[model samples]
Target: MAKLLLVTSLNKSPSLLLLSRTPSAPKLCPRRRCSSRADPEYLCRSIVPTMHYQKSLPRLPVPKLEDSMRRYLNAQKPLLDEEQYKKTELLSRSFEKGIGKELHEELLAQDQRNKHTSYISGPWFDMYLCAREPVVLNFNPYMSFNPDPKPEYNDQLTRATNMIVSAMRFMKTICAGYLEPEVFHLNPAKSDTLAFKRFIRWVPSSLSWYGAYMMNAYPLDMSQYFRLFNSTRLPKPNRDELVTDDKAKHLLVLRNGNFYIFDVLDRDGNIVKAAEIQAHLKYILSDNTPTPEFPIGYLTSEERNTWAVLRQKLLDNGNSEVLKKVDSAVFCLCLDDFPIKDNNHLSHVMLHGSGLNRWYDKSFSIIMANDGTSAINFEHSWGDGVAILRLQNEVYKDSTENPAISPKDMPASVDSSKAVTRLQFQLNNVLKEGITKAKDHFDASVKTLTIDSMEFKLGGKGILKKYKISPDAIAQLSFQVGFLRQYGQTVATYESCSTAAFKHGRTETIRPASVYTKKLSEALVREPSKYSPDELCMMIKECSMYHGKLTKEAAMGQGFDRHLFALRCIAASAGRSLPDFFEDQSYARINHIILSTSTLSSPAIKLGGFAPVVHDGYGVGYQVQDDWIGCNVSAYEVRDVGQFLECVHKSLEDIFTVLEGKPVKG
Candidate 1:
């Protein structure tokens, strides 16, 4: 779901984010360390050197024009009525014979120009960065970690310190080029030849792709060189007001409705142990006020373009110095001690700060609740969720490997003389009024969102295994059935399957609401009594297998949507009259994602996912585990999350019963 943005102003830290686990920390991969070079298995595989990954990786390929057009037409059929389909077909044929030929040739020319990167790179980059919308749930995605088991470890300071150490290690791994290259399944049947692809440019070669995915742990104030500072996204209008100083190594601590900064790196540019970090936090926790009269952070919740303008005005009106101090800090840590333990509530705070409690622009924030629950809220403009998840998986693993140090374990020379620096924002009456307005806007906007997180014990993965079906395919098919049952029609669905099978690959659209999907769901819902359980099961299998086939195609970078998007871009670039196909109602109808879904599988992740993409749609992040299936369903006031979850549950049960040869009830 991540696209690179090519803006000069560096807001996103192009790096891996974070992940989570409970008392027993989870491991991402079973291989503890690199196998012996002398081993037979190690010798069998030709491992490329880390530094040469880019050189070894192949460039993203352009799909055949005819193949893409055929798939595109087939995808549009289900979303359009017969009359609309006829019009779409006529327009599509005209384009295939006329303007499309020229555009394809132009695209080939553009591909030659950007031979190193894919044809979609530049356009994808603009789609993310050029837009002025605030990257919250609409853009930036987030995932909350399971609550810390040890009460002492749950302490905000303790958890934050541990997380930082883990983050440092993760960064070190990236720098050392030891991080494992991601491998996505292209086609399970042809898995031998299409095994793995090195997508991420570990060390970007040039400015064109340089800093495109650089995960800079933002710096604050530094006592030494190479110290990183935390960059803060100040609340303003029209643009993102970034406050960062390269010299800063101090951590920005947000708790009890206030901001504090303290050095996390020692004078020698090494991470201070958890004990010292905790000591600094303990001092701040004492006698801190629970509320702030003016929450300047709330100003960030305003519309992005508006914020850019307002921030510039504020800078001119006299808050530049204070803003600098707040901006130039290292990473931000929020001590959000909320009463609710629900994942939805935690997710809400992490995605969009709990009203003045966070500055959401930093690459990553340590969100620690008073109950010791923690998660990371990050800017999605830079890295994808997997990048961040890799870091988190490391952190979760380390939490167990190196348990929190005792106070006695702290060094005798630990500095206690330097007090935590409280960041003071010099807000005039006008800025203060703007903060009030921002708070109102944030509260009103959030009030309309409904998030429902459910962990169903139906054992979806196990059931799928019993029936020999792909978990992902079944989950998606379940969503399709649920939508049809709830809305009485198949809505346009966007399912993100990895395109990490090629160099610099991101994601491709796996449209879930297909013609076969509709056919199967319609049969299941409307004429349940008309067919035998075996007959219905066979039809469902056909739909799930079709989904699986499309998913594999999407992963291989041969999907229809991106090719169509590239064609549209090409036509626009050529200054040619847009084809009638582009203007067809079918185009818009199929592109509007009513059900934005993705399945992230990890036994360690208890509750993991993102919010809805559109206001009236649902963002369904489901974890299809072995025993049970967990989902975090988010929707706006227009769509009920609870109702959607109920429909999904009913659909899964109905489908599962049919597959199990059980008679349908009622």
Candidate 2:
């Protein structure tokens, strides 16, 4: 196997942390700007203006053929019965010695051609962004912030000011390249990294640049800024057409159910002061006007294919200029009236914005409530949750700790030059009906989901540390044990592990429920009394080791799943159909992912949740704190996730007891 290597442009800076990661020999930056005058932003920001962390970031590597083959065969073991496993094993062996070599060569050649980036960028982008829509709970992920504990920070205007200020400051750091990239310290022995530098740059816009809501795939030539602080103007569908205005210079703010817009950046392109932003938000809240009867934002939550077709119909009526206001806006900011401390209410509002109050297509939108509560409703098309979550966490940190961000420090004045204005859309009868239909679709969709927020007190992660096991692996194994107890077998499971270690790397699947895990689960549930404490300990250790290895491989971009996916994509790109092995029923059955999960651990974030990718599956996002593990489990009506989580909680407790050398309970 090739050791991870990083080569950089002369302009790139060396990361101090990366140097620390491999301290014996350090690579120092050799080039510096020779010009007499430096960039003004660099001087003002008091930070480096280069991608220090990304300079030596390793390129995604092609795994050894035999290693990947063995891993693939092992991954499929848990999901298949004996007969199915044998068939999959046969198929795996055939591919390993046959067409798989050709595919591997093609992947290596592509990686060689694109030395600085991952091989999966183009295919992943099409799959993430332009390929799908309706863009609600399915693809779009959301995070709800903890309520402001301090009364002063709870004021909507005050909080909104802090948020905008913090965001501006953060963006400045990102632009200046002063931010640190995430280091994947998988274990002490080996490590990988993710290029978070792209996260900051990619979270701003470009989700809808192709055609704001066109059903037809007409490629549009529009340059989108990933860091622009402007708003995306989602004008109401004109005669059934959903249009967007991307040329706007201001952010669209919604308060008291009415929309308002003001300049986010001044004429000189510097971020407008937070006081100016607050003044505009306050101006919108001051007036009591009847909320618009047509809340078109709800339409975005309709079935994707349904919305695509309706959006094209809306364009046929042709109100291009009005649509432009919506298309070009950077993102939407909703200054809502109510305090949302309840998880259910928060999830509802964040997932599907209050009917008339959102332009769902914008890549990012912050909904700050009057009581200093807030949540983010972001388009999943642009980037994953890590980037947006980082942004939110930073904004929250600044707001909580920085006294200068307080609205009390504002210069008791408003910017008359940056006046807030409401956008008017001429809605025809068809468009009005579209809004009605969209609401119905949204209501129906919401009714199907049930989200349960749960926490397990395993005496903190330190308990696992004592046993020298990964806490995450235990959590994943607990889910497997619980599911096996409930469903009697493992369904295809998807545990998302980040592959951001490479340039523009997204994620690779870590199939958590392996054959070893399934065997353990079956033993635990079916014959707990038959297994001795030492035997159970060994089984648990084996399961954790299996999960840990798979996780590290995925993070290192050598996971079997994405490599297989890449092969299939390569065949399609070459105008050839996928091989028969891919079409096998066992392949689809083993990859269905009935339990979709990801772990987001941070001291700051309380809960991070996303709807299940499949209707029958459960989307579980968990945060493992020092003493407890908090999980937000969401499922459609098809599954009893609430009960499922209860089983998981009990299973976790049981595992801890067993590990502690206690006799099995019940």
Candidate 3:
């Protein structure tokens, strides 16, 4: 039976039609086809006759269509309203019942933020360092399962995440020192050039802003990052405009209130990506205002030096020192679950004694494949590689499937001795070996976006949507993402490209006059810092010093030279040749995904940032995924618990030493 709903407007006439979920074709009616051309139910339901009238839908004319729609609305209005009323009543009843029950909820009220728990402080987090803008992370839902979350399981995921980011977080002090005393000056419109366009660089307001909204539907297999903001939308429009003496162009908004502006070109280089990225960033600024941007320099411009090459970008600039201020490191630990019944006992044993560690009593995830094997995934935000893996080993060593096996089976002091011995040493030496191996394996297969011709050919045309370009902008970003994943073990995000006058000191700033140069720039640098970049970086910028912070004297060169350097710095940073910080162990390279539209195009770039973990006893630890792009940190550590503890100790020591601007010999 069709459910009834009361709606003042005709919008609710058909409950099925009223639904706003992604539309899927309806299932076929249950009745089978009849050779007699009629079935009793079909006749009673007015199907065959109704079909004739429904067919008229294809022949709609302005007046007739309007009249028919109104008549249809009137016909079903009563039923629709009744259905709406029923649903409202049902919803109200559920609400009242929930309030009346108030059993388990009262306890929850203790932690609730709003009504009863005003004095009870809720989960508070400062994502200012994690992003250019402050972002809030609420742990309530994850922490508030009907049954409490298992400490051990949470520990593991946190540990893995932290391990993956240790090196970058560990060097913040040094990185911050190198980041200050530098700035990128956005050029103002020149006197002779006219005040037609404005330019700016893109920065993200939140990490989720870049991962979720800015690069919302890019090609990268973002099944992972999307989870961070899958259901998130910034609710902010991304658009801006630029005006130069020659013409006005629109821009797009990027992560940090930066604006993006670009021009159409025939090249496969960073130029196109840069232009598009700048435009999109600009658009996000100015509230998606359809303004214009005046052209400046070729987007493919590359300036290798500034501070980014040496890991300065990772520095906090004294912004928020949560990670540096932490006295102890946070660690998460988890063990892989093999279906063997023994493994179940092993999993349980891992939870013993460490009062905080526990198996997720009732948590479960669906297995897309129905094979008998079960996969257990844990989440942790603390612990280094050494501590994490060693913990796993200990769990395995201590487990016994037989319930008959109890404390009686072991010496009275065994449990206490193990815990004490478990952390015998502070940190471990796992990273030394693991990172060496990871580098070799990773570098050999480093596949990222290539700024070459990216084309999508749609067969059997009459493609839906008003997009003129065949594959459209979306297809382009997707193609880039697909290419990156195939060759690289990372995620790609779109950064807004730029559209400003080429820096021509003391001269009337003018957009590039060479279409060929523009094309060459686009074809080669569309996705800079990929395995293959454009020749323009070679042609336009001085590539030698592209490796580190350009000295003040070097950066003080003429306008054209400075622009060349700036552009090169952008490309080199994107390409991973430059470090956002000095002591970074690995490189951080994010693909630039560009969107090309007829009037304006925007490109989105992804930045590597820090992830912090707050744990119960282990404390807090911060990690940076950009270790590969900047630092040479290993993804795993040795499996000795003693050694693992040592690494954490050393890392914390190093973090604080850097914060103090002095080295520690202990």
Cα error of candidate 1 at position 55, Å: 2.9
TM-score of 2: 0.82
Candidate 1 per-residue lDDT over residues 259-301, each given as its tens digit:
8887766675566666677677777766446568988777666
Best by the TM-score measure:
1
TM-scores for all predictions:
0.83, 0.82, 0.16
Per-residue lDDT of 121 in model 3: 13
Which has the better TM-score: candidate 2, or candidate 3? 2
Q: For model 1, what is the alpha-carbon lDDT of residue 496?
A: 61
What's the CA error at residue 324 for candidate 2, in Å? 3.1
Question: How many residue pairs clash in all the candidates, one count each?
Answer: 39, 25, 148
Q: Score each candidate by Cα lDDT.
A: 0.60, 0.60, 0.18
Off by over 4 Å in 1: 1-52, 149-152, 183-248, 287-290, 321-330, 404-419, 570-578
RMSD of 3: 34.6
Candidate 2 lDDT over 1-666, as tens digits, reads 000111111111111100000000011112211112133221123222234335344556767777877887777777777998888888878887888788878988887988767776665555544434456666655666775667777777788776776666555555555543333221312211123223323432233211111222111110111423343313232212223433355766776556566777677656677667777666777767777788656666665556655666666767555455555565678877777767766766776655567767676788776776777766644444335545666667666766235646553387543487776666689888988988887777778888887789766578887898777778888889889888887877776644444555555666788877887788788898888878888899999898777766776677777677777788778887777677878878766667777665433445556677667877776655667877677889999977898888877887887889886766
Q: Estimate the Cα RMSD of every predicted model relative to the unseen true structure.
A: 8.1, 9.9, 34.6
